[model samples]
Target: MSKLIIGRYIPGDGPVYRMDPRGKLLATFIFIAIVFLANNWQTYAIACGFCLLAVIATKLPLKTFLQGIRPLVWLILFTALLQLVFTTGGHVYWHWGIFSITSFGLVNSIFIFLRFLMVILISTVLTLTTMPLEIAAGMESLLKPLKYLHVPVEQIALVMAIALRFVPTLMDQTVKIMNAQRTRGVDFNEGGLIQRAKAFVPIIVPLFIESLNVALDLSIAMEARGYQDDKPRSRYRSLHWSHYDLYNLGFFVLLTVLLIIFREH
Candidate 1:
């Protein structure tokens, strides 16, 4: 759990880290589209290769990237198993009532699993490289046009930023609470499904209380600071697009075009 990398930002001087947050967000969106465009093994392989190049460019430790996906292993496996057991069309190698594994099912399962992994990796790279504030600012900039539609863009951005900023904090708090519970004779790992869930009740209740307290405190702080959505705010650091951003965006755009052209429908 300590090794979980989701929603945690690591400060770095890599090219990816220096690119504009908006560019990163756009690239991630495009990459997701590209992933879904993949159909056959060749396209999936290309997608995997693109993700590999991205992971390498981030300059983060391979172990760190792997840790980000570790928690999702079971989810990926479950999805793959569902695809394998349900999908039917190709040659069937085994059959047991409604559970039959066909060649098409196997292929689809493999591709789906790879797709899940690649998507996770790409998203992890974005969070690891960008700070919460940058994310909020980027989102706000991207959604500025929505303000004309009477959308509360700033408030929405603030809410998103705060939620992301608290992820690591909450994870750390959960870990601390779990340890405290363990000291009080709670065994989280040594139990059946229902038993383990019951064990977590003690942990969850206290965590909820703590979260409430934190939220209350934050609300008080914001009130003390006179935070208002209707007021104009000044930024400490403004975002500017550099040549690096252009290069990064261009590379992804070119990659997307190439993927589209070669992707098997």
Candidate 2:
């Protein structure tokens, strides 16, 4: 759980760490969108190169990103397996009992695996580079126009920020709870399908209680601070759009164009 990168932020002085979160957010979204535009080796190769560049730009240890991806390795493999077995098209190599591998399926499975991996890597970069508060601020800045429609944009952004900030805390709690359960003679991995599901009950029950307590504590802290969103609030730190941010967005745009051009017609 600690290995998961959903909300983990590593402070650094690298170029990527210096860009505006809004640009990072938009670039991440665009990268994810353009990933689907890739359909062949050339496009996927470009996509892979783009991912490599992003990871290198983070200027963090390679192991850090690899650890973030470790937990999802099986999921990516399983998805690839399904695509390889069930998808049918092109030259069929083998077919029996709904299990078959065709040329199309083989190609598709590779693409699917690469696609999943690329998305995960890019998302990990975003989380590692940007803090939850920055993410919320960026989102709120972008979403400010929604307030014209009577939407509570600030509250929405605050909720998202809180969720992201709490993810690592929750995961750490889950790990501790799992360890406590293990001490109580519960084995999460040493069980059958039903038994494994039952094993998680001990972990989940306390984790839920812990989550509630955390929430209550947060509420109290906010209340003590006299938290209010009815009006504009001053930011302790302000986000400024920079040329580096524009550069970040532009690189993704170039990657998008490359994918569109190289992808299968």
Candidate 3:
């Protein structure tokens, strides 16, 4: 809930931004699979190269991309630590009580760290390049087949759209509350566990109240329009897959096939 992510989207006209969101989402999954397929340093190097090539195509600054990763640094470190301390097979480098470090553990730790970073890096690219509403619309359109099964596709899409819009709004409100508390002499960063828990009360209470008000207002507005969950709805913008989407999807399929083949080896 910081302005940190507010300006996270670096505006640029690039091939990555131009690609269909559905295509990028599918490609990201395939790319993550390739990263996991890597069993050695060589394959990991290839994965890194692929990720770098993707970033280059985005036309966004390297610093901006790296900034998006700052939040996940702790998660990556924790994953590496868990693998290093628990995984045991190869020659041991160190031992103490129930804890031991081995070559296999070290190798696995590195691979796991790389895997986590790669997944987050690719996903961050998706959010950075595409607007949240577009992603929701794309997902809804892609899942249109569910409509024939009596699923509330349009309602689900509306929920996704609202959630996306609320993310930034909620973030901004959190910041405001933090700043207000800070003005009244509150220190969130330098607090002990209990103090920190108490500190969040001020911020969370307001956020909950404000969120409830917004939800009520939205529900009322929807009811005013005779909105029904299962009713058919028309989209202001239609979704269509272009040649680029088809080509990219084919590339992802090929990549997945190659990854599976090489991973088995």
Candidate 4:
């Protein structure tokens, strides 16, 4: 969980960090869509190249980006393994009892791994660069139109922002609880899968209780501050679109068009 950087923000002066939060959010959405549009090596390569460029532009330490990917290593491997074993097409390479490997399977597995990694990396970049408040404000601004339809945009944004903000806090809490459990002779690492899962019960129970307490405290604090869903709130910092935002949006649009033109069906 320490390696999980999904909700943690790193302070940086890079272009990515300086870009408007709304633009970053929109670009991330478009990038996710473009990832699905990639169906072949060429398209994957192009997408990955762009991601690498973005990573470099962030000027963050290479290790930080790698740490973000480390937690998903197992999931990536499992996905690749599934693709290799189940996908059947192209030239047959080898076959065994209920298992076979083919050239297409090999290629497909590689692409799938790359696709997942690319998406994760892009998302990591967004969170690492943008603050939780900025993300919430951006989301609220983007979803503001939904208010005409009676959607609770502010409440939805608040929930999302709170959830994101608590991830690191919860991770820290889990670690502390695990340490406490270890002191009580609970062994989490020395058992089979089921036993290890069972050992986590102590941690999970307390974590859940602690999370509820935190939520209750937050509710009280908000009430003390007179926060209301129906109240008109003003921000000390408002989002301003700059030329850089326009350039970023334009680049993503061009990228989407190129990917659509080059992607294989």
TM-scores, each model vs. reference: 0.81, 0.81, 0.81, 0.83
Residues 1-265, model 3: lDDT tens digits? 4435422455678777777877887787778766767787766766676677677878888888777788778989998998998988989999988788999999999999988887877877787887777778878777879989999888888988888778878889999999999999999987689999999999999999999999999999988989877566667866567886776677666656655655637
Residue 226 lDDT (model 3):
90
Model 2 weakest lDDT span, ten residues long: 1-10
Error of 1 at 225 (Å): 3.8
Off by over 4 Å in 3: 3-8, 171-192, 222-231
Residue 249's lDDT in candidate 2: 91
Winning candidate number (TM-score): 4
Q: What's the lDDT for residue 3 in model 4?
A: 56
- Candidate 1: where are CA atoms >4 Å away? 163-220, 223-226
Residue-wise C-alpha lDDT for candidate 1, range 1-265, written one tens digit per residue? 5566896789988888988999999989988878888887677778898889888888889998988988999999999999999999899999999999999999999999999999899899899999988988998989999999999998898899798878879989999999999999999998799999999999899999999999999999998999877999887768899987898789887777777888876
Clashing pairs in 1: none
User: Quick one: best lDDT, which candidate?
Assistant: 2
TM-score of 4: 0.83
RMSD of each: 3.2, 3.4, 3.2, 3.0
